[model samples]
Target: MGDKVVKFEPITHVIFDMDGLLLDTEKVYESIIKKIASKYGKEYTLEVRSELTGRTQVDSAKIAVEKMKLPITIDEYLEQYHPLCREFLQTPDLMPGAEKLVRHLAKHNIPIAIATSGNEWLSKIKTQNHVNLFSEFHHTVYGSSDPEVVNGKPAPDIYLICASRFPDNPSPDKVLVFEDAPNGVEGAYSAGMQVVMIPAPEVEEELKRHATLVLTTMEDFVPETFGLPPYDE
Candidate 1:
C-alpha cells in the first residue's frame, strides 16, 4: 500500500481544497443539507453527498434540490443555507495534520495556494477561524468568484486556473494537489497534476482510483514520498 500510494516524482507547488481537506467543515455543510432535505421527506445520503462534494454552492444546491425533490428553487435553498453556513464556517476545525503539513511546506518555501469550490464570501467565512494559518498560502482561488474557474470540480478548470496563478506558471506535472472530494481528485488528474485524496468516508472505491495517492487522513501523508522535505519532528 505504501509503494502504491507514493508517487516519487518531485513536485514544485501545492494546491489544497478548503472545506474537507484542510477544514472539518464538510460535515457541517452535510448536516445542513440533510436537515433541509428532511423537511421534504427526502434523504441526503452519503451517495448524494459524494456526488455533490467539490461542487460549487449553486451546483450543490441544484443537485440537492433535484435529488431530494424539494419544493424550493435553488435560490430559496441557498437563502436558507447561507445563514446556517455562516455560523459554522466561522468556527472551523482543522483536519488531522493539516496545520503541520501546511506549515512544513511553507517553511520549506514551497509555493502553496488554496483552490475551493466556494465563493469569496463563503471562503472568507470558512477561513475566519484560521486567518493566520490561511495567510501562509500564496493566494486562494475561489471557484465561484474566480473568472478563470468557469467550471467546478469534475472539470479541470479550477486546478488549471490555480496552477497558472503560481509565480513560475509551473507545468501541470510539477504541481501537486491535496483534495478531499472525488470530483476534486478527478479535476486535478484531468489538469495533469498529481493529487492526494482524503475522500469522504462513504466515497466509492471507483472514485478513489483517480488519485495518485489516497490516505485515510492528512496524518498519513509523508512528504518525502512526493520528494518534499520530511517533517523535522
Candidate 2:
C-alpha cells in the first residue's frame, strides 16, 4: 500500500500457491476435465475451465454439476478426476521459473511454504515428486476436504489458515504471497498479506483490484531484481 514496488528485504516469508504458480499443471487438469466431459456428452468450455481456476477439485465439481447445470454429480466428477490427477502428477511440468525461484529463495534461506487447496494426492506430487525443490521449507499446508477448513479461493479461509500456522509471525504484513489467479490474490489479500499476482494472461483483469504487484510471469522474480539480498556473500 505504501510503495507499489516490493522491497523483499523487509518481507520475512514467502507463501506460494502450487498449481498455476509453481507448476504448469492447471492446463493438464483443464484438459482432463474437457476430455472427461466430452466422453460423457457434457460441454466443458474454456470459459468454464477459467471459472474453475483456483477452486478445489470437490468445489469445482460442485460448480460443474450444480452451477453449470451439468448432468454429473459431485461423486461422479471425483470418480473421474481422482485418477486423472494421479496420472497427471506422475509426470508434472514445472512452471518456467519454478526451479530457479525456489533455489534462489532457499539459497537465501527465506522461510517458505506451499498453501494449496489441493488434497493429499496433489500434495504428494508437489512435495514428494519435487522433494529436492521444496524440501528446505518449514511446512506445507494442504487443506483437507472438510468444508469448514476449506472455503477454497476468493473466500480466504485456506490462506488465513496457512498464515496462522506461522503464529510466531502471524501478522500478514511480514509475509509476501505469490499467486497466479485472481481468487488466490483475493485470498491472500483477505488474509491481510501483500500479494504479487503472476497471472497466466487469461485472467489479467482478475488481478486488477487485488494484486499489490501484477506481473505477467514468475520469470522476473529474482531476489536482487526485487532488491532483496543474494544468497552468496
Candidate 3:
C-alpha cells in the first residue's frame, strides 16, 4: 500500500469566533491601543497583541495594562478605551470572504452560530451595519456579557455554550470552528472540535500547530473539505 487513505469525518454544525475573524474590528482596537500606549511611552507590540487576541474584554484590559506598564487601573483603561471602541467600531468593515461564506452557509441551511469574546453591547455596535448578515446566525454567544459563560476563549466555555444552544446540541467532534486567534483555536481544540484557523500574519508558526487546519484567509477556505456545502457558483 502506497499511502493509507484517511476518511473525512464530516462536521455537523459550525461555530465562528468573531472580532478579527468575522469583523475587521481588530484594527480599531490596534489604533486605540497604540494611541494609549504612546501616551504612556509604551509601544504596543505584536507579542502583546498575540496575548490579548481572543481574550475576554476584562482579560484583554488587564493584560494590556500589565504588559505595557500603562500606569492605569484596568477600570481606568476601559474608561478610556470603551468610549473610543464605541465610536470607531461602529462601522467596522467585514473581514475578507466573511459575508460570502456566512451567507452561503445560511443559504444552504447549515447550522452556524457566533462565539465572541466581546460583550453583547459591542457586538451590536460592530454589526449595526450588517444586520442582515448577522441575522443569519442561529444564535450568538457573548463571552464577556453572558453570565452563563464563566470563562472566555482558551477555556472551551464559549464554544461549548454556543454548540449547546443550537436546536440539537452538536457533539464536540461534529462542530467545526473557525477562528483567527490562537486562544480561540485552543478553546475549540480543547473542546475536542475541529478548528480552522486564519491567524494574523504576525502569529508564529508554532502557535498555529494546534489547529486542525490553517489558511491564509477565509477566501482560501473550501467548505467541501470539511463536508460543508460548497458554494453554488
TM-score of each: 0.95, 0.86, 0.95
Give the clashing pairs for model 2.
none
Q: Residue-wise lDDT of candidate 1 within 62-129, one digit each (tens)?
A: 98888778999999999999998887678888999999999999999999999899999888877787
Lowest summed lDDT across 10 adjacent residues in model 3 is found at: 1-10
lDDT of each: 0.89, 0.74, 0.91
Against the hidden true structure, what lDDT does model 1 obtain?
Answer: 0.89
lDDT of 2 by residue, 1-233 (tens): 44456444357778898888887787887788877777767887757766677877777788777645767779987898888877776667778877877877888777788788787666776556687786766666765454556478877787777777764655677778899877778888888887888887766463457787777778766555444566453
Q: Local error of candidate 3 at 114, Å?
A: 0.2
How far is each candidate from the true structure, as Cα RMSD in Å? 1.8, 3.1, 2.5
> Candidate 3 overall Cα lDDT vs. reference?
0.91
The reply for model 1, stretches above 4 Å from the true place, is: 1-7
Q: List the residue pairs that clash in candidate 1.
A: none
